[model samples]
Target: MGALLNQTCYLCSNTKNSIVFVENGIDIVRCSNCGHVFSTYEQEEHYEGYWDDDSSYDLGWWDHAHREIYQDFIKRFLTAPSGKILDVGCGLGFLLSEFKIKNPVGKPRVTKYPKKRFNLPGIKTD
Candidate 1:
């Protein structure tokens, strides 16, 4: 039996009926009650590999999408006169770059994974 078969549902924390979803050699189980989905331990390796692949890390396509969303978020969330804004989980620093360009008068800081440096110019990492 797979690990999911013995585990409780992730949504409602119930130990009752659950549904399994399998795609691209990955397996995830969902709770029927609250509709929460979780992957089994065996699927973690495959999921990590999929994300860690260099091709997956390519940010060209993601940059365009993120830029639009980031702009909208900034317009909606930022209302202070002038303050420091720190962005976390900033993949490739594209959002930070956009924020800086849009808000030249405000202070915007970006935080990223130490090993994953963005290819954009003028992004400083240590």
Candidate 2:
């Protein structure tokens, strides 16, 4: 847990927010102005390969059922899911691999957003 600070909604920068839910002691608040949902605690940068650490195995991540549910949602919502789909914050490239399998017509490239926003894959310019 990190130090709690006065957090304004990043989307609307609105201070008017109320706690909607609390997960792992972090308050998830919803901005009254733009209806943006975010956490109260700031994200602490852990060491490299931090997310891969399953020290808290009870959390039960990497659940294929959840992934399938999301894929089904994508299939239902996004019709033209062709071409390349960018998987920003693609931890361990699991979702990207799944995308490659699900949407073989599309290419998925994983990259960390903002800082290293553009890592263009090798494409035939011709």
Highest TM-score model number: 2
**lDDT (CA) for every model shown?**
0.50, 0.51
Best by lDDT: 2
RMSD of each: 10.7, 10.1
lDDT of 1 at 9: 53
Per-residue lDDT over 44-91 for candidate 1, one digit per residue giving the tens place of the 0 to 100 score: 344443434355465678777777898787777775666346553425
Q: Which regions of candidate 1 are displaced past 4 Å?
A: 1-57, 81-83, 101-123
Per-residue lDDT tens digits of candidate 2, residues 14-81? 79987888778888888999997877875444334453334454323664546787677567755575
Report backbone clashes per prediction: 0, 0
Task: Give the number of colliding residue pairs in candidate 2.
Answer: 0
